[model samples]
Target: MSATEEAMNRRIVLARRPEGEPGVEDFRLEAGPVPEPGPGEMLCRTLYLSVDPYMRGRMNAGPSYAPSVGLGDVMVGGSVSRVLASRLEGYVPGDLVAGFNGWQDYALSDGTRIRRVDPELAPPPAFLGALGMTGLTAYVGLFDIADPQPGETVAVAAAAGAVGSMVVQLATLRGCRVVAIAGSPAKCGYLREVLGADVALDYHDPNFPETLEAACPQGIDVYFENVGGAVFEAVLPLLNIGARVPVCGQIAHYNDSGNPLPGPDSLPRLMMWVLGRRLRMQGFIVGDHLDRLPDFVREMGGWLREGRIRHYEDIVDGLENAPAAFIDMLRGGNLGKRLIRVVPEDAAGA
Candidate 1:
């Protein structure tokens, strides 16, 4: 590579901790030299960057399931990258991989947590969405944790998103009647028409709780909790006896300032429902279930080949726009998996 190319590594770092909703000011984009790989290491050029809701938590100062992103550090994220140079044994130049390359244009990896991606099986970006961690999250959360039976009513929040979209389709394949919830009409249409959800409801409607209850006439047998707060409150009273709730994400509450929400305490009501219905609520981190990845890849791969599943992505161009896209995703502005196209589509294959 030319010296100019090696000097063109651009990165987006956390400029400051967000107060409530994060703004573009919280991130600063800067250019730096792309470092050469040492023995047993590889240099990779990032192609696609994934912007997820969990990243919001990582930006905070408090402790979470993962360590917080330190100020002035490269923001944490996953990426689809191409091996540019390698001294690693198995990896070679031109090989594609999925790994934690963060929000940088180039990164070095010693093969830790890195997986080779076969671009022939699926498009490269799919590795960052349905065929990668996102798909595994849905598979593990729904089948392993929630365990919805055939003919059960399964309600999924954020039903048009990456993980939720997979859960909607997989639940349908399992013979469960799915009631999908989204923030907008367009996303609701995609959930019902494209994803094959039995019923789709717009959560912005004033009567969303009542509408959701009406849709699940038999009561919700399984609730995939993606958005917490009001969405959780709505699903609480509608849970059937022996219901299972897989707490996947709580996007709505991620931006809160840690103060209690102003309202009557609803813990007593939630407790009563849990006690009377014997509901099983479990929160899971996808990293904890990596042992099942091979099985998921095998089955989900076949489903993709047979056209039994379809994945959607909302991609933004350039690394500079990632912060805006991420902030938009956090506010429920995205229709599917939100990704940043670090490399232009025409040149991505190169």
Candidate 2:
């Protein structure tokens, strides 16, 4: 290998799967010689790697919407990358792209499913956030599934998060009164001040249930379920007749080892309410709505450009920091989209 090629690669792998919440010991960082581009492949230097709650599910040894990361495998993640070398037909060395490039400083792809990102349109990190999966999740879950109409009350749990923030902005743009539930007073303040939520409440408050009840006097017409344990329990009582719930994620239960909590089982009561209220509750993985990607891109892209939609990101430095960043995300340590800067691929441009 050439000396220049030996200068640039680092990777983080799954050292072991955690029984519950993942820790730094569950990951390993390693350095190696930079890879060369092969026929039909392009070598990309990662710019930003995303850390998300869904990654927690991938750490467990069980069936989920996606496959779990095997022990000793490089951690899986989506990233924004710049092509450092290219053997692929359509890609050039400077082209920026977004794809599932795992947790690494460098990755090689054949360019089949990669999307070329226009740096002129948005910054590289935006590809890992607002214009990417997070935005798409909020767009589809709110419009396509929940279908909130004007004057309806929309309540979203984790409302200050990457996806939930967009849910608030989009619902407000549609003329619905948005009630946001966040982890702390600070996050609740951001939701109300920056995102224009009509009402923002802290889930940590002792009277959170009563606060939510007061906020949604007309009842919750649309409940965007992000955190699924106690938050869902609180939302259950506020759901209006024929309310629509688009179950996007379950961050609250992501760290749980699938063991039932000791308590009066709430399923029987929940089932009765579901029947009596005639509520529509459905779970969705983003892949299930692939057909709407174009629609999301067009409409949400416009919302972003028109200043009707806003996004936030909490960036952690270095690939080695991803494990801690991910763990903190589960505990609501992050305020928006969590991302790690893997390398300085777009430094000169940004």
Candidate 3:
């Protein structure tokens, strides 16, 4: 009936709005009795929880594409969970699912749009990543927005992270010369050696702009803007005429108070490039492309089965560690899809 009428639940709630960079203290661990499910509803036990850069934006008390995480509310996230109890017709106990279960140990759902997780196809984390929103975002941002052509050069910032890694794989398979940009040399190596990027460069290099120039001698045809800021400045000059830019994320500016980044060039310079190069740069929310979910699942599923698409996860154990994992991921401390294993694999009692 009410929140206090159900079983005990443990969760991470938003403690405070971050001023600049979000600190670990911004989240608070809370315990309360779980809300009971009514008719046409179900209770889900969280298995794997996602920690993303976008969550940092939600911690602020301001208007965004989505509503902000209210102070004392559960920190928002996507999770792979199992149905612990159900009053709905289709859902039953032990049915694995993927939904917006947040950082809590359990969730109460009215059985609206949540999808079942098929472990036979892929692992649970893959749904939170590659075969899920992360992969779809990469698909839309690269193929739909960027529209990269074969034999052309396509560059990606944050190239070793979840969406960025997928971008490199898709663009590379599409016959584009993929150049990966990342924060460290190890990530650069992973991009080049493992993901098959044609060229991988470290953005932390003092002469990064020059290095990017040398890598893309023929000029970049499509630029997947993930870590905007200094990366944006480096990409602007190397764009070819009629180049496409998918403004997916700006992780470099996520911690900024008001100003996203204080790079050498101004906004006026960016506008000039857009006008002069006939460039088309647009922002997107993957949720906007939900109509294509079936298509994504089929194709991405095939790719996964055939080993055409490979995914990675930087997994941390325990639900209590979720906040720290999220904080670390924001700082590029993780190498892949950062996730918290809220429950064990045998949590369903095998």
Candidate 4:
């Protein structure tokens, strides 16, 4: 289709800056003409759009690792899409690729920042989950940063979610004993039964900290932190000397406005522990470790192919449901990697 003919595309835009927690009114759905691919560009139809906790930081008005979405602009996101038309030499129609396509039915890209996918090796949605950023986050954080050794105890919060789930499986594959902390009993069961965690505890329990302490009697050697706030507070005392902490996300504090939680500032105590114990605590964005992506893809893909690493996806249908799905994800409603099926590319036969 010609660029002018494709101008009737639909998209979700940022309606307003969210305060505390985001509501449905914060997004505006609009219909516009399909944008034509310019010279050296390609037209893409989104198949799967990712909904992640990190996007919460982009909705607020502040300086972040990435730019915040401006009012009336299409909300930014990563998506797996099929190239509808290509002006770029390396790309062609029917090629599935992953890129920053935002939240929409279709997007135009200049062939930069897009990676082609091999569907025969894995399904398309795997490009958004296991073989994509989520897998990279877990692999890089655990192997490169945390560096858990064989027979060591590793603890992960939000252990049944995307990054956390991958960490549990990978750590287990590495011969490390894994203890997982999930939000509910069901999620904990998935961690133990499906992902092979050595032990799983529900964070909702009144004595969750005590349970976690009991689970890690040797102290946590590697802590893959996905949920911060209370979980971090609970894990602080349980960290062994020379332990490694890979700070990935802080979903627990994502919806908090500016109000501090009821507690004394624990920075001093944390610093003391860091100094006294010679612990390594580091925060990282997955993009910073892009050089390791090739290694991660090769290893993770092999594991998945061998039935060693299993992944789950909680997919919602349509572009319009993105906002609600995102809100629900922040509330721990999603069991695994939360995604929205923007188009039924994978359901071609159905």
Best by lDDT: 1
Steric clash pairs (candidate 1): none
Query: Clashing residue pairs in candidate 2, if any?
Result: none
Q: For each candidate, what is the lDDT?
A: 0.90, 0.85, 0.88, 0.88
TM-score of each: 0.96, 0.95, 0.95, 0.96
Stretches > 4 Å off in candidate 3: 1-7, 259-265
Worst 10 residues of 3 by lDDT: 1-10
Query: What local lDDT does model 4 show for residue 232?
Result: 86
Kindly list the per-residue Cα lDDT of model 2 for residues 37-127, writing each as its tens digit: 8899998888899988888888888777799999888899889988878899999878899998989988899986588787766677877
Residue range 42-89, candidate 3, lDDT tens digits: 988888998988898898877888899999999999999888778999
**Residue 153 C-alpha lDDT in model 4:** 97
Q: 254-345, model 1: which lDDT tens digit per residue?
A: 88887534345676767778899999999899999989989988898889888998988899999999999999999988877899999864
How many backbone clashes does every candidate have? 0, 0, 0, 5
Query: Model 1 — which ten-residue stretch has the worst lDDT?
Result: 259-268
> Which regions of candidate 4 deviate over 4 angstroms?
1-7, 259-264, 346-350
Q: How far is candidate 2 from the true structure (C-alpha RMSD, Å)?
A: 2.0
